[model samples]
Target: MSSAQCNKSAITLKGSSEIVCEYLDFGINSILFQRGIYPPESFKTAENYGLTILMSQDKEIKEFLSVTLSQLKDWLTQKVVNKVALIITNVASLEVMERWDFNIEYDGDQSQGDKQVSDKPLKQIRNEIRDVLKQVASSVAYLPLLDCLCSFDIQIYTKDDVNLPQEWAETEAANIKNAQCVKMRSFSTNIHKVNTMVTYKNED
Candidate 1:
């Protein structure tokens, strides 16, 4: 995980509509155009080869990924491009806790004066969030993208969980499978300032 504060200027540019034009002119190998607004510098290091775009609102990248799975169904019949790399910006960690309605409770004898706390381990909660996102990214979007492109290698670049739930580390290993598609991993970085480079692989 590469964590750093990004430049504000880059983030502003990324959110602007001009980002599409800017990236097109960037002449990079590939573009993981996260429709969500964030920093632009992160993509500066992408290989100058083929350019691919992924678009969705900043708040809805996960939802968009879920919906895109079915959209790429036809591409499966065409050439096999089995690998894809995902670049996400503005990952809302709190949303996970909100979705799961996770909370802590305390129950103990007041007279005895003992602390009996029951709380979802932060790590466990974070893992649940990671698993959910990973499932959505790999099983839903990346898999479909591979099926459409006719390849199988996929990689992801994302932000490191600050104050994350413990289960996050283990969850990542469970959601990915090696078959028509293999080797899915995620890189972590902070998108609050400058942009970073992410690598994605697909095999058929």
Candidate 2:
């Protein structure tokens, strides 16, 4: 195949990063709605991946996620980000109740540099992501209910060599005591693969 033909079929690093970021946005929103971190009325239905997703309508939340995803896209392009976690905590006690981890894996050669590409079809990758989101939406059945008022924060794990952003600070890991973990399906863009897992406090 000619170089131009090969390039035409390739998924660029930036493209994969955007896909991954979009998945995280939808995944996090689904978790928030399913886990009741926010009121049901705070979300609105949106179509994506052939599914109707509930997305946040709050201005502050939208802005926060927008900025966070933008930053994540940059890191993902650099291939420095390893995992992105959503930590849900009890508002009154400030104790972590659940942690949703979207663990990332580089599916391409590291030495190929940022211009590397993946041959995976976008449609297939999106379908895989849709399946994961469906499982996330249905997870409320087995996951313990969050009975108290809760809040959430996003923690990003990056390579140690990465320079910390001035506004970002280090913090302790969000771990649940007597935790029960559930691993869900994963999706890949050929360049990047993401594994989904949830760890929650085992009330029993």
Candidate 3:
């Protein structure tokens, strides 16, 4: 089958799970870069999803993401994770200034261990990523300027039946005060789908 045709059909569960994690890696890095949470010198440009994307080079940041994304991918493969939020906080006060929420949805009727092909193609998934990346790049037009240093945290929500990892802890939802939320684009594999929304400290 042609590349286009392949992307048009649903991919296996394992295949879709990997793509989801890859998207999270790129998405988080994109947010940090666009929001100026990290210094520009710490990142290098790379190509992904037909766009020039920035990947972090800072050793600490890279290690952190590697560990976090690994856990997220494993949870995703088990279909136990429900939500993943990227929380950006003020460096001084440690207050949550912005949040990038990625919510996952699955067919309730489908049980675990189903490695069925996704109904959506890979090509279509890239298109959705393109739209989101464009918005992230232009976010400075609306998002507040960060005049001070900032840090970020990844918060994951999972089903009650999940067995928590030794390092993972449960915490209250990171709510942004006086939030102004903007719903963004989404894409899916037949087995799993993700919807995105961003909430920022509204300056209103």
Candidate 4:
């Protein structure tokens, strides 16, 4: 490949990592808005994926997601972490209400080397991510409403051998009792593919 051609097509590990994190940022915000975990007033609409997306405006929530995804991007670039889960719980009862799991896998031959690069076009990947976000937005039609006050927490599932950060302590998996799951669309950047699913407490 010529120098210019390679430059146009190459997608580095760090670049793909940033893409995944950005998707999570928008995806999480979409869920929070649709599921009514936070008041609608706390979120503002922004354009993404050729559609309007509501992102959280709360300062603390924004900072939490920013820092968490920064560390996660590093793990993603290293191919150490496999899953990121967003757990929503009832604030009053402390009962697990809903869980959104974003399963990650290194895609194609890119996983074979330390320097990950893919020829997949960025526009195509963004379209795929848009489809996933659309599914999340329409999820409210089938998913149950959050009747009580709720809060959210993010959990990262990493490989057993990876060293933990001083501030990052391990916690038990936030499993929901009598859970019913709904599988959502998956998106890929050729270098990485993320499969999304939501498991919720079954009221029936």
- lDDT of candidate 1 over 106-139, digit per residue (tens): 1222232212112223343234334323332333
Please say which candidate is ahead in lDDT: 1 or 2: 2
* Best of the candidates, lDDT: 2
Q: Which stretches of candidate 3 lie over 4 Å from their true place?
A: 1-10, 107-113
The C-alpha lDDT values of all candidates are 0.25, 0.93, 0.84, 0.92
**lDDT score of model 3?**
0.84
Clashing pairs in 4: none
Model 2 TM-score (2 dp): 0.96
Tens digit per residue, CA lDDT, model 3, 138-167? 777888887878999999999998888798
| Clash number by candidate, in order | 38, 0, 6, 0
Model 1 lDDT, full chain set: 0.25
Give the 10-residue window scoring lowest on summed lDDT in candidate 1. 95-104
What TM-score would every model get versus the actual structure?
0.18, 0.96, 0.90, 0.96
Q: Which ten residues in a row have the lowest lDDT in candidate 4?
A: 108-117
Q: Which is better, 2 or 3, measured by TM-score?
A: 2
Instruction: Give the CA lDDT, 0 to 100, for residue 38 in model 1.
Output: 33
